[model samples]
Target chain A: MIRRQPPALVRRAAGPVLYRLARLAGGPPPGLRRGRDFAPADLPTVVVVVAGADEGSCAEVLDAVSRAQWASDAFTPVFVVDAPVLSPFRRAGYVVELAGPGGLGAAVAEARRSYAADLVVVAGGRGPEAADALTGLLLAQRPPIEGPVGRSRRFLRAAEARLR
Target chain B: MSGAGPEVGRGAPPADDVDVLRVLAPDEDAAVVAEELSLVAETGSRGAVLASSPGLPEEVLALVRRGVTRVLRPGEPVRAGAVVVGTPRPEHDLLAAVESPVVLGRAELPAGAAALLRALDGRLPGGRGNGPEGPDPVGPGPVAAGSSGRRRVLLVSSNGSGLGHLTRLVAMGRRASAGTDVHVLSMSSAVPLAAEGLLPYEYVPSAGDLGISARRWNVLLHRRLGEAVRRFRPDVLVFDGTYPYRAVAELGDRFPGVRLVWSRRPMWKPRMGAVQLGLVPRFDLVLEPGELAADLDRGLTVGRGDALPVRPITLLDQHELVGAAQARTALGLEQDVPTALVTLGAGAWHDVDSQLGAVVAGLRRVTPDAQICLVRPSIARSGADPGHGVRTVSAYPLSRYLRAFDVVVTAAGYNTFHEAVAFGRASGFVGVTAQLDDQPQRARWAQREGVGVDLDPLDPSSVARVAELLVDERARERCTARCAQVWPGNGAAEAMAAVEAVADGASGRELLGRAGASEGRGGREREASR
Candidate 1:
């Protein structure tokens, strides 16, 4: 999907204010532990949203998160999913929170409120394809893959490349 | 040694309670004491020698050579806050003369002197009770000796044109004593610190990188640095950059306990960087990495006594580099073929494509089969193709593989300039225009010293001339021979000693201030004698 970014002036003025406001709005979930003492505090937090109790999607997203390289134990990860799928992620030593009754939007909001992640990767499918897409989103957290393709096409190309 | 009774010396007590130590050594161990005193003076502390004879002791003269000029009359009353080191004598009791903070016997010679040195280094906590006959107060003072005594140091590097600032800080961080814990917070993207196991490294984006205004970026810097200061609780904070950010200067007032040292490299563009020099006094120490072209230095910091001078700091020592064949294999260049490495810095600050093209054309024209390797700086925004036969190799501290190339063509930045000469590689220097660095002067120094030829990128003839020298065997020998004659030993270890001293308690401001005052007094005394 192609999206237009806000003007540079607006971003320059509002970025820090919004960051501070978001930081103040929510914090890590009640029992969610802080990262290790030496871990950089500015690492982009990650929120993985998995719909329903689809075990395949949960497993795929979990696998992608485990393999990503943002430094060993550097970023904070919060998985928002159906209550039934929470055990696997929890057993994997990740912070797992059950999605509220209000569905996807509410689940994302609650996760954001709990972890304040900078990037969100949604997992809604049930195969290796979904995991590949999740991996592309994770890679997009960097300055977006540099190449000859259009901005929208770059992400899609990244996803396609990962699939192959 | 005027036989008069003890009288106090000029100057008030240091507010931080660090005493200007007076060592009264007996005749036998003077040489050993002199060696230790030179190390102490190197850390930015003045050593006072109490002598009664007309001729000074070897230790006292050694201290003078290290820029300490304070001499005390034998019977001068020891001032308050001055620690006394002397032998217990029958007629004269040095301890009983005045209320000394701490007195040491000669039996505890070097070890006792070392403890006092550590105390002066600011490694010890302030306001510990040390009476006239105190139990060795220097024993495990503030920063102790064992594993528990490891000093936490926070090194901050700014995003300069290239990795000059970050490289210098890394040199110090890697060479720091095992008892020091180092954390780096850099604005440069290519920190490479975590790879070295210098953990807890953080990257803060530069204002240009963030597309933000300098004002707002400074605000962000203040918050980020303040947060790091609180979390790291560093005993010493070292910043290496031309401009000491207002946020960094403010750190002193905010965290009084954290000793701040500014690792400032000199050879600034003449009359440039004066505004930045105003912040030098704000720091506890201004560590000036000595420039090879010191005589040619026309910059603002040229005559400044405030900064403690150390040898030119290079990340890799000469011994650390591999042999030519080994380096060639590592870089994948074939043996017996001429190769030249062109690293003109990151190309982010200034575009070097036209210059790079000229060099390639020149090299190909002179030596067709010569492998031309360009260093793809880690911080460069994007890599451009350098035509055919030229490959890009990335390496941290490229000095490690410097031997692989017969000739190195580079801009005269602090790190690359020193590394090329110190490693004794034949080189051509292109003086790139920089914000504050005096690159042209460095290139001129190289030419004058006969170590390298200065080339102009825009001038095709000059590029062709240097390109010929690159493949010429005899020219290469002349350059390397001159390099051997001119290269000063690596100052990384000495620079680390200064940092450790400042981390312990030696204040650059106090030491330099006293140095200036003492020089002033000596000037007046010489005039009176004349």
Candidate 2:
């Protein structure tokens, strides 16, 4: 199980906090892919949690972000999925780690604490316009958040303040 | 008459004592809880029903586990503060149970049962005074002044390799509906088909897919099962599965009013062993859906004198089948071209698409004019393009369009096998993986009975064999003739009658063996007269 855990760099971005929360929600079932180095650790992590499944398209978003200003190892863009979509990111040569089974709120809260997340982005659901705005702000490296970002920002703000 | 109804529900809502929950014990008008909760569910009301079983009925205890209704001791205070029916408390103060329990002085439960039902209904969000409500009136169907009457049948089925268990439940539920209201609770994703077949159904989702610990899944299932029982207040609960779950025993002992019938199919492979057999006696009755291979059955669970065996039950009726020309037009094939429906059943669950693709592709070569249609409609929805010029037709009960095809190539599943034989549609069985149901055994039986052909689905030449059998008029006619001789179209009716008989207190091996009626009906009738 330790061998399957995220690499040292990923462990740095995602503290043991997320695993504890997932354990409470009954953790990922057997065979669910564990953390595989998703984003770089040098930059403050920007955890992107996909609320609905459709993780492939979202992985493409992360891939696009990494190619642009985000830079592979700059700001860690950890994807928090309900289920895993590791292969697409792996194929695209982007380091995409996953934390799951826990709902989005729990995943984002833990991400904020573990990474001192500079921003948390939620995108890819029913609203297309909102997804575009978040995608734009994220690629452009906005603050903890400003565009159409939803509830996770409040959690990140509080976690950042508490850390300070 | 409802004076003995057990009440167990959760806490009362704020302010109004009438804001109670719904729990149904054996002696109570079971639909009363469903009727009440259906309202609360609609009105967004949140609370539980509170009632006490001084005798502590097993039925009431089970409801407590589901948190459907709160159970109280004989003298314990009612928590939900719902209606006080009859003389439940000869010892305790009703006022202590709640700020104001609805206790009617000298009010006969037979008389107040109506008002008690209405009081709970009136407290809902869009009550008579609150706003305009929908068509269904809240309470139990307006009972005749002195009659404690209402009948709800609960049909529960476990997931099988295919729709066999669920389809049989659907057949039994539809037949049971002729005399009683029926609701189905299915543990398969295909549960939506129940609604399409015109039965009210709830999908519990198969536990196998949850990826959780067994203990946790069991607890969740126990609570869900209890809640379904409480909501439906079924007089008869038919659990149709290969092996009975562990909770059925406890549930049976508690709900004395619910006549538990184990609606099982025959053909359990000898290797499955007798572990499930030990639990059969826990049910009020064991219903075995008769198979063509009863004589060949080495299954330990079914076919004993203690179990009732009816004709092979199927969801399709002969009269309901679409005419070949109409079905052909609907399916978009020319009348002149031969059509073969490769209805492999839920074998699609396995990674057999590539294998089936080869079989169908091979089939298209043998019978060039034949239009091949794969029966896995869900494949396209799952985004798998089964593109070899074989379109996917997803119509429910595929039996409705049985006439459209000259032949059907399918898995050796009970529903498909029974329907094909019953409808006299020539078919060839391509055996699929089944954990307990021995499809291979049934496939051989079907072939020997002259009703179908069977072969290993993966065999390279199996497609040619299947295509040849379908195109051969003589072979197809022989198969159809054998089918016509065997199917009696009485399985569902006989099963329903037997189930009702169990509810009416009929038991013993003699009663069970009487499943095949005196008229020598069912397949026997087909041989003798039809």
Candidate 3:
């Protein structure tokens, strides 16, 4: 025999109960996540890093990196991506690499060691939880990356003179 | 030089069997013919003497021999391959002797003679077919029997302050060339007509050098004009404006056959001294455009017709206006704004400044939204401010800019006034110079016909009145329509016909007789007296 459930009781039980479960479990949604970031210091050379889970996620990472490189000053870009994302970056003419699953912290450190990097940038997160965690870790280490704030102001001044 | 009739050795070669030869003489026609004949003979060719007559004066014969190769008398037989040369009279026996040969005459030769000459010279008849022998039929020798020849007219204009008279005469000369040649002998710069290819001209000493002023220059010019008249020997002589009266007198005496004409477009009282009037009768004809014929004294008036506009209104093409637009755009004007053109014909020592001020004020009031282009004779003296909706340009080619205007406000210089009328635009006339005797009359006439409005420069109210009228759409339309009826821009054709009639010695007497008959008419008489 099938037992009939009361709708009002079910609705009341679901919200608070799920919230407590998720706080303990700490897992993200099932969709693949992808991200990338770039900074160009030498006008003709750019640097990029990307992270993703699946092929589609890796493709998204590469596309984002390529667009950033094209928009920046004309440059040969160096890319560090998740192992699965490297093939697409390589096809796109970037000096590329396979990053292990620990995300871009090690990649940023390696880029600084291997190439005399003028800037360092980070991008992509599985979700808000993972993004928040990665940002917190990056803040603690403070990689030797030159930020875009001062450079953006200088570019703006040059652009303004050209317009006049 | 190969084929010949009876061989006559040189040393004033006998006029028996030769076609023609050049010799020096005072007679220019004979000299011209001799020169042409010499050119043909120097080419080393034999030509037939198709016709000869003792009636050709010895002076003319002597002139012809200087260039002619082999001139043949009436009964002389021409060689088989000779170029037959002679007059057009069919009775000449030498024409029958040659199978086909080149011929000579004062006018173009008859088509039949040209055909015959071309055939005998081993050239195709009609100058189009192939020849079995001799050179290809490049063209028929100048068929001189009936060809319409050029009748050269010389126009002498003074370098006076205004170009009104000179401009009008230039138009007349251009029109006169329909069946004749025209050469202008200007004392001033030979206007832009040369660049336009309208008339060929040369410059003489300035009118000032001809003693036109209160000084001794008039006497010097009188003598110089006489010398020029003797030198140019025109078929017809035209004196534009005044100060060439003594020259006209001298031309009458020196060149008795030449028809001496004067083109007068003055609107003011004659400032010419009393002695000047005595010389007026010597002119063979005085051509005045429009009702001006009525003003000329009896017998002096030879032709009366619509005067040709001094500026070519219809001739100002779209390209000229487009160029002006581009220029104005470069000078920083909004290309879309309605433009108004204001001009005062080269101002004399009159109330030019005051007149210009009134026009500026009126233009500002009427065209608050429009750009005003003031074409000043002297931009420095006019002192118009750019802030008052006015831009002063020194001497714009007015006809080119006239097309850019919805309306033109100007003084009654012959050229400016007619340009407005010809282009079918609304105009306002500000009478500034009493020296231009025609201005007041033209202005009144234009007003009556509703083609233009006349503002009295002396009256402040008149300026305001014109300013108010400028904004009236109906008034502008009415004026433009009326102008079309009065001056349809064919005055040049009429003037040409009148000139042709006079030059042909046909219509001149009738025109003069009509003028004499109309003497009793009080209206024209009154205008003349004024």
Candidate 4:
């Protein structure tokens, strides 16, 4: 990626001093690294359909997961996003992969097959739209197996059955 | 992205347009489309035209008929603009050809607008494609500065037991909306503040009041939140509560355009576990508005990791403050009178009668002619009629009528404690025993820092301290001096800047720029207290 334009930092006294101070405080978080360097070994692909609009939301979720010990060992955050969202996530220190033109469903299947994963937890932008996206992914028959979504009791039972 | 308002001058970024590329899944709701159009009109953004879906629902067509800028038929000469949300109107194959930002905030009107308006956010005026405005700015602060449209902020207040959440939000809203359009969707009784013209507000019933299950509350909250977002179309959605409602967090995906900033003030008693941190990731920024007594803070989230700490965000901002003389005049009080303001917050004080009597006694002892003003919830609620000896002041935000008092005696609650000190009044913080509050800690901090007197009404020495603070000019001056030594009263400015940064999609602590002086003040205060 291109070395992006400098960010805008507003201080009462505009100078390099405040900028260096802000820099000294810290970078993103402990777990965040600046690269696409996650191993293929992190299994059970977690499909994050990050919206270009509020790209920060997905980044925040990933940042949280990064803070959690050993969470990166179990889940791989796969991104189904437009161009604007990719750089921020990458810069924040997570290995990122982009979704092709076939849309999210095809992308989920491809990630799962490539990684040989047991489950694919899918989430989309909120409200009924999220439920709709999950339904689309789970109900697709080409995969021959319907996976579970979320931690609801019903989904848990389905996930248990799938695992069994 | 806020620069989308029509007020933006010519050659400014083209943010004033409804640019959602709605891909109708053949069987889409026309009402939703019409709602979107209405929302577009509401924000003064040029409404969108659906490209592919023909045979419009009559309601959607009516929007066009009613001068909605109508849906442009496919292959028609369409006004080209940035697409805000959803896939291209075409099927899978055509999606590759459509080089437009996808529909991220499908349910959220404001979030959708965030994504769409952002197309114009960093770009220079008169062009759409990415130009050399330097490297494309990322994170939340960039767009906060020079922008085209009015930066719309929807401040959501959690309906907690205390008014701390709502009051803090009001302080922030008043300051943030100075150059932005701010609306409050309060889950508490603070809807009345809207009537007073503090800011445009709508009341949504709290989950506790509604008596719904947590899951059900999330559903209702998201529904209400989505509706509010539709109406407000905020670039930034601020959740001012201890914890964000799950539904509100879930809306992140549906309305990816709107950046969610969590303004959580930590003073949690009972030593909360890490359960609440689960939601931390959902926010674009978890802004911890610094507490004046933050050193004494023992709240679980008070100094927990991952949050950007700002200055003490108090309700009594400098710009909106009332001077001592003006406040006395407004309340029809004698300017030279040694008036003691006993502001026992709206919390139910079991010994309220005795509390008021003691406060009055302290004032009388301080000076025989000293006036007594007890600022409580309301005259009806408190039923505090002490004849003419005590005046009942029921300012919605007592901060406005604060200068009416020479000394302020109040509960050590977050808002009142901060307000008294921020207004530069010699204050007495009476520690009220309350669940889930850090009043005791606040009271101790006040006493330690010499910013105010910590009064435990029942304690003789505490009452004596109050009396001394009221009458002793040196004591009052010392307290005022200590307060002046503390952080600058620009918490609202810092908070608004943070919100602006988040809305702008610039990451990192650009808003933390001016915090140098604040940190220095804090360091000195800590050293002085030690």
Candidate 5:
């Protein structure tokens, strides 16, 4: 039970690839798995980690969240950021929190606690196309257990469980 | 629930009402624009979009003043269910091209538009401009000044560990236009403005003081600031703080009609340089109080064109200080003995104990009978006792009694540096390590200018250097001469004039032009000095 966590760079690099794999292997509808045929009155929230130094990449990730096919309120995005976010994101109604010295994981944890979010997502990609490619995967996620469990890990865990 | 389902719109659809409304009408009449904006406000629309066009800057300003939170640009993409308003002309092509439903916008809220708004309103949670907990009934613009014909200015200062922000605001308020009714609204516990003759004070505890989350604190700030805006009906609200809170930025949209000015000082740490720069546009005016070491400034506010740069704002004018003998007598110090004041600020941290000991020990080595006064800043929670003989004095507006000390030992903060140099006091500067302030840079600048000696706290030899500087008559004379030569005139009067002008609706360009003139003169002086 002593699995080592991957380095942040490796996790970041693997994010989009994992998103595609998860989407291609879609399971039951996210709502049905939660035992509700109808949409929940209150949407679950997600702490999206907009980390790293690239502003454009961060914007693309946010764009992906905005374009996510779920209801406009499908999941409220509380951005845990390590980079400078443009004012437009704020105007777009995204709540942004600056990541502290503990880096992206700490920021995600703090954001989740502050916002009472059910899940976390690492919003990183090579470009706008990658962001677009991951939109469906972002919406089709269920709540993971506690701690800074990002989308890549959640997908990999589900895949591992299926193999078992 | 499965996250993937039939396309039933993004997120669960709200009961009714639109999330945002987009209007793309160019060259519309002023009355029509006003009515449309009013309807936007009345419905508490979360955001609005207007067709950007020529002669629309004022319309944009008016819309902002009417309390519309987010106004999208023509090409900026919005989520589904946003109702677009305007005929599909060449100018409106981009906005109309969006997939959302389009409807013709009228001066009056049309039944079709109302229904569309209802549909969008329920689409997003908390889709209200002035929320339920927010102050009700958005009122008219700048009410009359009660027969005085003078405008009212509400000066708000953040809860800084020192009185730097509060002092700057007090300086400006005291010098406001003769009949202008000025009120002080602050979150700082230090409200000694009454001593400076500026009355009508309101105090609100900061998030730290209340031990509340930032979200809750923002809500509290919104409620309190809203209440103040309603009560004071200030023509301009000038916030003196490092970080302009979300509530402060939302003032234009929340209360409407009140002009917002941020009175920020420079000399921030390099790490804190650009994180908050984006919030600059939120203010109608960003008034930067100039620093003495402007040329040597390495902080974030350097070379910024958006802010109007004024000369260093000090709490008291040079002439306001009492003569040395009278100042000494006022502070209960012996008139004949050599005296030095230590104002390193907030003795609770930064190894102030060692710094204080070094300075006191150094001054005592030169003149055993030297009188030393330590200025305990009003905000310090607790401080290390400076042992037996060092006199601990707490004074608000300490600038008024600067002449009490023959030599001054202090931190290189904005207010203290300007006052020490302006008063031509022989001084020694110590740079405290602060997250937001570049104190070492300031201390070095004073040393470079030959106005003061920079003392290094970690260097044990600094003790002897302080003693040498204190006792060296030639060094004292050099400091006095250099201070007199380098001192810039007080900018409080000019800053107040700019604040009042901004209150009367002066554009940032106009004020910046004046700042440019000052900067130009300073540049000329630098060239002349070379």
Candidate 6:
């Protein structure tokens, strides 16, 4: 029989172990924990989303996240690249192009639905208007995983473990 | 054993029968049995036994088993025979009944008794484990000249209130005097002299008497500081505060032969509006402690040293620092806990309350477990109470506490800043006094170098941000490493060499001619040279 440990001890041990495993796997650890009854059906397909007013910044974020090990088999990156440059990411097999020429809020919602994304990673300096819009949307949705992009892989791993 | 009835003392007496006894000395067997009986009475059971006793006192025998039966006669033999007890026997009745019993004969104790006594001595109230005997002497040795016929250098800092300027002067004097005579002139209470062990000149009276408004006491104290210079005439006069500008300028005119040097710490803004306006010019040579050179553009427009003087005058440096673990052990602190040091200059300002509050608040948010130590130069005199979670140490040698810190949080005072940078302790600056704008400016320079963060002492958010940055292990390590990179060692020695060259008149005419010729290039080139 498996002896049960205290919840506090299990939580403490789980975070560090998960972080180590994620590091070994060369990816940011997933921070959220699933319900006891969670199954394959409950697992929302993951996607990395890049939102910014500047197309250059958005492309950079898309390029960085796609290159990460986590984006390999674990999640698909949905680059909501503005109309300017959609070809580079499309050719990379990661793009699920959203149809309207819309602002950040529309881009985030469109990307989230199109890719069935469970987590959102925003990158680049979008000025105050985009920041407010993104913040408002994120707050309303209350996504299980969210953070600034371009942060170190180690920080992402730590953040993921904490959320879990 | 089957035939044995309830045993009575000495003879086969009836259980209900009573008998009075007078136990005498020298009856070993009987005394042992009587002692065992006493033990039974005391413990309320036969848990204890007297292995052997040479004699028994009459008073003790009478009181034994008092509640149960009468005492037995002394000549009566013990029916129980000699009882052998456990090594640690139970309490004896002889000791219980008699308040104070004086036995006449010599008492023989077991061999283990001596060892037991020794063990008890280890736990005794007064013993050898008292804390390290007394305060260790921390002051530096007397300033000595390295070469014979070396010029005597007198460094007088009239920057009363805060000893930051004064401390830098002392460190500079100590270094510069390696080939020259060094004396310090101060109007500060005798404490600085006593702590530094320097020859002090006469004291100037209150700032009010020196024509400085009570509001601007720093300026007034400096006005009267010229008295010290006049008294201790020397080859080189070094002034280390902003207030003593007029006095330093006057001294330069009064004794043209004497070299006047001003060591300016970094400033956030100019101290004197008039000086910023180019109304008054002070000092033949100005020494910028750290990166004051970068901010002031090497004192080009200000008529001061253009480059920062690289002097070997600082106490906190890599070679001087004790290893972090060793320092913690020496200071009796938990080896694992992160330590942070907070310090302010000697001056006691009215706004100290707010500044200290901000620091405490920031510390609470960032690293609550981080050990915080507050070091003030005049800890003994200021009596400034650093609140909870803060340990206040007097003007003990900074060298002792320098290595103990993983990070140092302090106001932008010149001496402490230089020390913090030199020692590679991740430092954070909180601007305290506006009288010396050099502090905030210095903090900015340090921030630019990635050595530390500069936070507005008055702003709660900024303080909290600094605290957050300091607690993060990665940030702290990177900052300290960067600080070590920026500050190469031996600044004090270099500054002193420059001062010595000027004092010997070798660089005087050349420097003056350069100062007069290009005016702009000379000052900037001079600073850059150092």
lDDT (Cα, tens digit) per residue for candidate 5, span B1-530: 11221112123333323344556456444454455545555666555655656345565567776566346566665543344333323333554333332122222232243433343334223312111122223332444333456788999998723477888888888898776888887776455333224566655546544333344456546765765787677888999988899989878876557888999888888758475778898888999887888777777888678888787888788778888788777766677766678776543322436766667766666667666777755433324446545665655566788877778888887778888898888888888887687888888988888888788653546655655665677887788889888877888888888989987779878888877897799899999989
Question: lDDT by residue for model 6 over B410-506, one digit each (tens)?
Answer: 8766666677777777878865566536466667777777887787545767666567665678887788778766665756766666677777874
- Candidate 1: residue B499 lDDT (0-100): 83
RMSD of each: 26.7, 18.9, 40.7, 19.3, 19.9, 33.2
- Give the CAPRI rating of model 2: incorrect
Worst lDDT window (10 residues) for model 1 chain B?
Answer: B1-10
Question: Candidate 1, residues B116-158: lDDT per residue as tens digits?
Answer: 3443333212222211111221221122222357788889999
Best by TM-score, which number?
2
Task: State residue A162's C-alpha deviation in candidate 5, in Å.
Answer: 35
The better-scoring model by DockQ among 1 and 6 is 1
lDDT of 2: 0.55
Worst lDDT 10-window in candidate 5 chain B: B1-10
Stretches of model 6 off by over 4 angstroms after superposition: A1-164, B1-148, B190-195, B198-202, B205-233, B245-247, B252-256, B266-273, B276-284, B292-316, B329-332, B344-353, B376-388, B457-461, B469-471, B507-530
What are the per-residue Cα lDDT tens digits for candidate 4 across B1-530? 11111111113342433444443445545566567557656655565555454577787778778896566444432222333333312322222323331222232333454433333222212222211111112212212222457788888888633477887888788777456888887766435542237777665545443332243345445555665675567888888776677767766776777788888777777566467678888888788877888777766775456677877777766557678898888866777877888766443223435765666665665566777776645312434545545676666666887767878888887777887777778888887877566788898898888888777544556766777766678878888888888756657777887787777676535444445456778899989989
Query: Quick one: how many clashes does candidate 3 have?
Result: 46
Ranking by TM-score: 2, 1, 5, 4, 6, 3
Error of 5 at B20 (Å): 44
> C-alpha displacement of B116 in model 1, angstroms?
49
TM-score, B chain alone, candidates in order = 0.67, 0.68, 0.56, 0.64, 0.69, 0.57
* Per-prediction DockQ: 0.01, 0.02, 0.00, 0.02, 0.03, 0.01
What TM-score would every model get versus the actual structure?
0.56, 0.58, 0.45, 0.51, 0.55, 0.45
Candidate 6 interface CA RMSD, Å: 40.6
* Superior candidate under DockQ, 2 versus 5: 5
Better of 5 and 6 by lDDT: 5
